[model samples]
Target: MTPTVIIQLFVFLLAGFVGFQTITRIPPLLHTPLMAATNAISGISLVASLVLAGSNQGLFSTILGTIAVGCATANVVGGFLITDRMLAMFKPAKLEAKESVA
Candidate 1:
Protein backbone atom coordinates (compact mmCIF):
# COMPACT_ATOMS: atom_id res chain seq x y z
CA MET A 1 0.00 0.00 0.00
CA THR A 2 1.02 3.60 -0.45
CA PRO A 3 2.64 5.38 2.50
CA THR A 4 -0.36 7.72 2.81
CA VAL A 5 -2.79 4.81 3.02
CA ILE A 6 -0.64 3.02 5.57
CA ILE A 7 -0.40 6.16 7.69
CA GLN A 8 -4.13 6.69 7.53
CA LEU A 9 -4.78 3.10 8.53
CA PHE A 10 -2.45 3.44 11.48
CA VAL A 11 -4.18 6.61 12.58
CA PHE A 12 -7.61 5.01 12.26
CA LEU A 13 -6.56 2.03 14.37
CA LEU A 14 -4.97 4.25 16.97
CA ALA A 15 -8.03 6.47 17.19
CA GLY A 16 -10.29 3.46 17.57
CA PHE A 17 -8.15 2.08 20.37
CA VAL A 18 -7.96 5.42 22.14
CA GLY A 19 -11.67 6.06 21.80
CA PHE A 20 -12.52 2.64 23.20
CA GLN A 21 -10.17 3.12 26.13
CA THR A 22 -11.41 6.62 26.85
CA ILE A 23 -15.06 5.64 26.74
CA THR A 24 -14.51 2.58 28.91
CA ARG A 25 -12.83 4.68 31.57
CA ILE A 26 -15.64 7.18 32.03
CA PRO A 27 -17.84 6.80 35.14
CA PRO A 28 -21.42 5.67 34.46
CA LEU A 29 -22.76 8.68 36.33
CA LEU A 30 -21.03 10.97 33.82
CA HIS A 31 -22.46 9.29 30.76
CA THR A 32 -25.43 11.64 30.35
CA PRO A 33 -23.19 14.68 30.01
CA LEU A 34 -20.84 12.77 27.75
CA MET A 35 -23.77 11.71 25.60
CA ALA A 36 -24.75 15.35 25.13
CA ALA A 37 -21.17 16.12 24.12
CA THR A 38 -21.12 13.21 21.72
CA ASN A 39 -24.40 14.38 20.19
CA ALA A 40 -22.89 17.83 19.62
CA ILE A 41 -19.89 16.26 17.93
CA SER A 42 -22.14 14.13 15.77
CA GLY A 43 -24.15 17.20 14.82
CA ILE A 44 -20.92 18.88 13.72
CA SER A 45 -20.05 15.83 11.64
CA LEU A 46 -23.49 15.90 10.03
CA VAL A 47 -22.92 19.50 9.01
CA ALA A 48 -19.51 18.59 7.60
CA SER A 49 -20.95 15.69 5.64
CA LEU A 50 -23.64 17.96 4.22
CA VAL A 51 -20.91 20.31 3.02
CA LEU A 52 -18.95 17.45 1.47
CA ALA A 53 -22.00 16.02 -0.23
CA GLY A 54 -22.62 19.33 -1.92
CA SER A 55 -18.95 20.10 -2.70
CA ASN A 56 -19.17 18.90 -6.31
CA GLN A 57 -15.84 17.13 -5.88
CA GLY A 58 -16.84 13.86 -7.60
CA LEU A 59 -19.62 11.32 -7.84
CA PHE A 60 -17.96 8.89 -5.45
CA SER A 61 -17.17 11.56 -2.88
CA THR A 62 -20.68 12.97 -3.07
CA ILE A 63 -22.18 9.52 -2.60
CA LEU A 64 -19.91 8.69 0.28
CA GLY A 65 -20.62 12.05 1.88
CA THR A 66 -24.34 11.52 1.53
CA ILE A 67 -24.00 8.20 3.35
CA ALA A 68 -21.91 9.85 6.02
CA VAL A 69 -24.55 12.53 6.46
CA GLY A 70 -27.24 9.94 6.96
CA CYS A 71 -25.19 8.00 9.48
CA ALA A 72 -24.15 11.13 11.36
CA THR A 73 -27.68 12.45 11.44
CA ALA A 74 -28.86 9.19 12.92
CA ASN A 75 -26.08 9.26 15.49
CA VAL A 76 -26.86 12.82 16.53
CA VAL A 77 -30.58 12.21 16.81
CA GLY A 78 -30.24 8.94 18.64
CA GLY A 79 -27.66 10.36 21.00
CA PHE A 80 -29.88 13.25 21.95
CA LEU A 81 -32.86 10.95 22.36
CA ILE A 82 -30.93 8.64 24.66
CA THR A 83 -29.55 11.59 26.60
CA ASP A 84 -33.02 12.97 27.11
CA ARG A 85 -34.25 9.61 28.34
CA MET A 86 -31.36 9.33 30.74
CA LEU A 87 -32.00 12.81 32.08
CA ALA A 88 -35.64 11.96 32.59
CA MET A 89 -34.60 9.05 34.74
CA PHE A 90 -33.33 11.53 37.31
CA LYS A 91 -36.47 13.68 37.40
CA PRO A 92 -39.17 13.14 39.99
CA ALA A 93 -42.24 11.34 38.70
CA LYS A 94 -44.41 14.42 39.20
CA LEU A 95 -42.11 16.64 37.09
CA GLU A 96 -41.79 13.94 34.48
CA ALA A 97 -45.54 13.50 34.21
CA LYS A 98 -46.10 17.26 34.03
CA GLU A 99 -43.61 17.61 31.20
CA SER A 100 -45.00 14.62 29.40
CA VAL A 101 -48.56 15.89 29.69
CA ALA A 102 -47.71 19.32 28.34
Candidate 2:
Protein backbone atom coordinates (compact mmCIF):
# COMPACT_ATOMS: atom_id res chain seq x y z
CA MET A 1 0.00 0.00 0.00
CA THR A 2 1.00 3.61 -0.53
CA PRO A 3 2.23 5.69 2.39
CA THR A 4 -0.99 7.69 2.34
CA VAL A 5 -3.07 4.53 2.51
CA ILE A 6 -1.00 3.23 5.40
CA ILE A 7 -1.42 6.48 7.28
CA GLN A 8 -5.16 6.53 6.67
CA LEU A 9 -5.47 2.93 7.87
CA PHE A 10 -3.54 3.70 11.02
CA VAL A 11 -5.70 6.75 11.72
CA PHE A 12 -8.90 4.78 11.16
CA LEU A 13 -7.80 2.01 13.49
CA LEU A 14 -6.71 4.49 16.14
CA ALA A 15 -9.98 6.38 15.97
CA GLY A 16 -11.96 3.16 16.23
CA PHE A 17 -10.02 2.05 19.28
CA VAL A 18 -10.28 5.41 21.01
CA GLY A 19 -13.97 5.73 20.29
CA PHE A 20 -14.64 2.25 21.62
CA GLN A 21 -12.73 2.89 24.80
CA THR A 22 -14.33 6.26 25.36
CA ILE A 23 -17.83 4.97 24.85
CA THR A 24 -17.30 1.96 27.05
CA ARG A 25 -16.20 4.20 29.92
CA ILE A 26 -19.38 6.27 29.93
CA PRO A 27 -22.00 5.60 32.63
CA PRO A 28 -25.05 3.66 31.51
CA LEU A 29 -27.38 6.51 32.44
CA LEU A 30 -25.70 8.79 29.92
CA HIS A 31 -25.89 6.41 26.98
CA THR A 32 -29.18 7.71 25.63
CA PRO A 33 -27.99 11.29 25.21
CA LEU A 34 -24.71 10.08 23.86
CA MET A 35 -26.51 7.92 21.32
CA ALA A 36 -28.62 10.88 20.23
CA ALA A 37 -25.53 13.00 19.69
CA THR A 38 -23.83 10.19 17.83
CA ASN A 39 -26.86 9.79 15.59
CA ALA A 40 -26.45 13.36 14.41
CA ILE A 41 -22.78 12.76 13.71
CA SER A 42 -23.64 9.58 11.83
CA GLY A 43 -26.12 11.51 9.73
CA ILE A 44 -23.31 13.84 8.71
CA SER A 45 -21.22 10.83 7.78
CA LEU A 46 -24.10 9.49 5.70
CA VAL A 47 -24.10 12.69 3.69
CA ALA A 48 -20.36 12.47 3.15
CA SER A 49 -20.76 8.89 2.02
CA LEU A 50 -23.42 9.92 -0.44
CA VAL A 51 -21.11 12.52 -1.92
CA LEU A 52 -18.29 10.03 -2.21
CA ALA A 53 -20.52 7.45 -3.81
CA GLY A 54 -21.77 9.95 -6.35
CA SER A 55 -18.38 11.38 -7.23
CA ASN A 56 -17.78 8.90 -10.10
CA GLN A 57 -14.58 7.70 -8.55
CA GLY A 58 -13.01 4.38 -9.47
CA LEU A 59 -14.77 1.09 -8.79
CA PHE A 60 -13.02 0.43 -5.51
CA SER A 61 -13.82 3.84 -4.07
CA THR A 62 -17.39 3.60 -5.24
CA ILE A 63 -17.77 0.24 -3.51
CA LEU A 64 -16.21 1.51 -0.32
CA GLY A 65 -18.40 4.60 -0.43
CA THR A 66 -21.50 2.49 -0.87
CA ILE A 67 -20.51 0.36 2.11
CA ALA A 68 -19.85 3.46 4.16
CA VAL A 69 -23.28 4.79 3.31
CA GLY A 70 -24.89 1.56 4.45
CA CYS A 71 -22.94 1.49 7.70
CA ALA A 72 -23.66 5.13 8.49
CA THR A 73 -27.32 4.77 7.70
CA ALA A 74 -27.54 1.73 9.98
CA ASN A 75 -25.71 3.57 12.74
CA VAL A 76 -28.05 6.56 12.59
CA VAL A 77 -31.17 4.44 12.56
CA GLY A 78 -30.00 2.08 15.26
CA GLY A 79 -28.85 4.93 17.48
CA PHE A 80 -32.24 6.56 17.31
CA LEU A 81 -34.00 3.30 18.01
CA ILE A 82 -31.83 2.59 21.03
CA THR A 83 -32.21 6.13 22.32
CA ASP A 84 -35.96 5.95 21.98
CA ARG A 85 -36.08 2.65 23.82
CA MET A 86 -33.93 3.97 26.61
CA LEU A 87 -36.09 7.07 26.97
CA ALA A 88 -39.21 4.97 26.99
CA MET A 89 -38.02 3.16 30.07
CA PHE A 90 -38.24 6.42 32.00
CA LYS A 91 -41.75 7.32 30.86
CA PRO A 92 -44.72 6.58 33.08
CA ALA A 93 -47.55 4.55 31.60
CA LYS A 94 -50.04 7.31 32.38
CA LEU A 95 -47.99 9.82 30.45
CA GLU A 96 -47.83 7.51 27.49
CA ALA A 97 -51.60 7.07 27.57
CA LYS A 98 -52.14 10.81 27.81
CA GLU A 99 -49.83 11.48 24.92
CA SER A 100 -51.49 8.80 22.82
CA VAL A 101 -54.95 10.23 23.49
CA ALA A 102 -54.03 13.69 22.32
Candidate 3:
Protein backbone atom coordinates (compact mmCIF):
# COMPACT_ATOMS: atom_id res chain seq x y z
CA MET A 1 0.00 0.00 0.00
CA THR A 2 1.02 3.58 -0.59
CA PRO A 3 2.39 5.76 2.24
CA THR A 4 -0.70 7.96 2.10
CA VAL A 5 -2.98 4.94 2.50
CA ILE A 6 -0.95 3.71 5.44
CA ILE A 7 -1.12 7.09 7.11
CA GLN A 8 -4.88 7.29 6.59
CA LEU A 9 -5.37 3.82 8.05
CA PHE A 10 -3.28 4.68 11.07
CA VAL A 11 -5.29 7.83 11.73
CA PHE A 12 -8.58 5.98 11.37
CA LEU A 13 -7.48 3.27 13.79
CA LEU A 14 -6.25 5.82 16.29
CA ALA A 15 -9.47 7.77 16.13
CA GLY A 16 -11.51 4.62 16.63
CA PHE A 17 -9.50 3.66 19.69
CA VAL A 18 -9.79 7.11 21.21
CA GLY A 19 -13.52 7.30 20.58
CA PHE A 20 -14.08 3.88 22.08
CA GLN A 21 -12.09 4.71 25.19
CA THR A 22 -13.82 8.04 25.66
CA ILE A 23 -17.27 6.53 25.35
CA THR A 24 -16.51 3.65 27.69
CA ARG A 25 -15.37 6.00 30.44
CA ILE A 26 -18.65 7.93 30.67
CA PRO A 27 -20.95 7.22 33.62
CA PRO A 28 -24.36 5.69 33.00
CA LEU A 29 -26.08 8.91 34.04
CA LEU A 30 -24.35 10.85 31.27
CA HIS A 31 -24.84 8.31 28.52
CA THR A 32 -28.21 9.66 27.40
CA PRO A 33 -26.91 13.18 26.85
CA LEU A 34 -23.78 11.91 25.17
CA MET A 35 -25.83 9.69 22.90
CA ALA A 36 -27.99 12.65 21.93
CA ALA A 37 -24.92 14.69 21.08
CA THR A 38 -23.42 11.83 19.07
CA ASN A 39 -26.68 11.49 17.15
CA ALA A 40 -26.30 15.07 15.90
CA ILE A 41 -22.77 14.30 14.80
CA SER A 42 -24.04 11.16 13.07
CA GLY A 43 -26.65 13.22 11.24
CA ILE A 44 -23.89 15.42 9.88
CA SER A 45 -22.03 12.32 8.76
CA LEU A 46 -25.15 11.06 7.00
CA VAL A 47 -25.37 14.30 5.00
CA ALA A 48 -21.72 14.08 4.05
CA SER A 49 -22.17 10.47 2.98
CA LEU A 50 -25.16 11.47 0.87
CA VAL A 51 -23.07 14.04 -0.94
CA LEU A 52 -20.28 11.55 -1.50
CA ALA A 53 -22.65 8.90 -2.80
CA GLY A 54 -24.32 11.33 -5.21
CA SER A 55 -21.08 12.70 -6.57
CA ASN A 56 -19.98 11.30 -9.91
CA GLN A 57 -16.90 9.65 -8.56
CA GLY A 58 -15.31 6.44 -9.82
CA LEU A 59 -17.14 3.12 -9.40
CA PHE A 60 -15.08 2.11 -6.36
CA SER A 61 -15.63 5.45 -4.68
CA THR A 62 -19.35 5.32 -5.41
CA ILE A 63 -19.64 1.88 -3.84
CA LEU A 64 -17.67 2.89 -0.78
CA GLY A 65 -19.69 6.08 -0.43
CA THR A 66 -22.93 4.14 -0.70
CA ILE A 67 -21.77 1.82 2.08
CA ALA A 68 -20.83 4.80 4.22
CA VAL A 69 -24.28 6.27 3.64
CA GLY A 70 -25.96 3.06 4.75
CA CYS A 71 -23.81 2.77 7.87
CA ALA A 72 -24.32 6.41 8.82
CA THR A 73 -28.08 6.18 8.27
CA ALA A 74 -28.24 3.13 10.53
CA ASN A 75 -26.17 4.89 13.16
CA VAL A 76 -28.52 7.88 13.23
CA VAL A 77 -31.65 5.76 13.44
CA GLY A 78 -30.23 3.40 16.07
CA GLY A 79 -28.97 6.32 18.14
CA PHE A 80 -32.43 7.88 18.22
CA LEU A 81 -34.06 4.59 19.13
CA ILE A 82 -31.61 3.98 21.95
CA THR A 83 -31.98 7.54 23.17
CA ASP A 84 -35.76 7.27 23.21
CA ARG A 85 -35.57 4.04 25.19
CA MET A 86 -33.17 5.61 27.65
CA LEU A 87 -35.45 8.61 28.11
CA ALA A 88 -38.43 6.31 28.56
CA MET A 89 -36.80 4.88 31.66
CA PHE A 90 -37.02 8.30 33.36
CA LYS A 91 -40.72 8.98 32.60
CA PRO A 92 -43.33 8.74 35.33
CA ALA A 93 -45.50 5.64 35.15
CA LYS A 94 -48.65 7.76 35.21
CA LEU A 95 -47.47 9.82 32.26
CA GLU A 96 -46.64 6.70 30.36
CA ALA A 97 -50.07 5.23 31.09
CA LYS A 98 -51.79 8.44 29.93
CA GLU A 99 -49.76 8.54 26.75
CA SER A 100 -50.52 4.91 26.08
CA VAL A 101 -54.25 5.50 26.60
CA ALA A 102 -54.31 8.45 24.27
Q: What is the lDDT, from 0 to 100, of the residue 51 in candidate 2? A: 94
Write the residue-wise lDDT of candidate 3 on 1-102 in tens digits: 999999999999999999999989999999999999999999999999989888988888889889999999999999999999999999999999999999
Ranked by lDDT, the better of candidates 2 and 3 is 3
Q: Residue 10 CA error for candidate 3 (Å)? A: 4.3
CA error at residue 80 for candidate 3, angstroms: 0.4
Q: Is candidate 1 or candidate 2 better by lDDT?
A: 1
Q: What are the TM-scores, per candidate, against the unseen true structure?
A: 0.86, 0.74, 0.83
Q: For candidate 3, what is the total of clashing residue pairs? A: 0
- Which run of 10 residues does model 3 get worst, by summed lDDT? 53-62
Clashes of each: 0, 0, 0
Which has the greatest TM-score? Answer: 1
lDDT for each residue of candidate 1 in 1-102, tens digit (9 for 90 to 100) = 999999999999999999999999999999998998888889899999999999999999999999999999899889988998898889998997897899
Q: What TM-score number comes out for model 2?
A: 0.74
* Residue pairs with backbone atoms closer than 3 Å in model 2 (clashes): none
TM-score, predicted candidate 1 vs. hidden true structure: 0.86
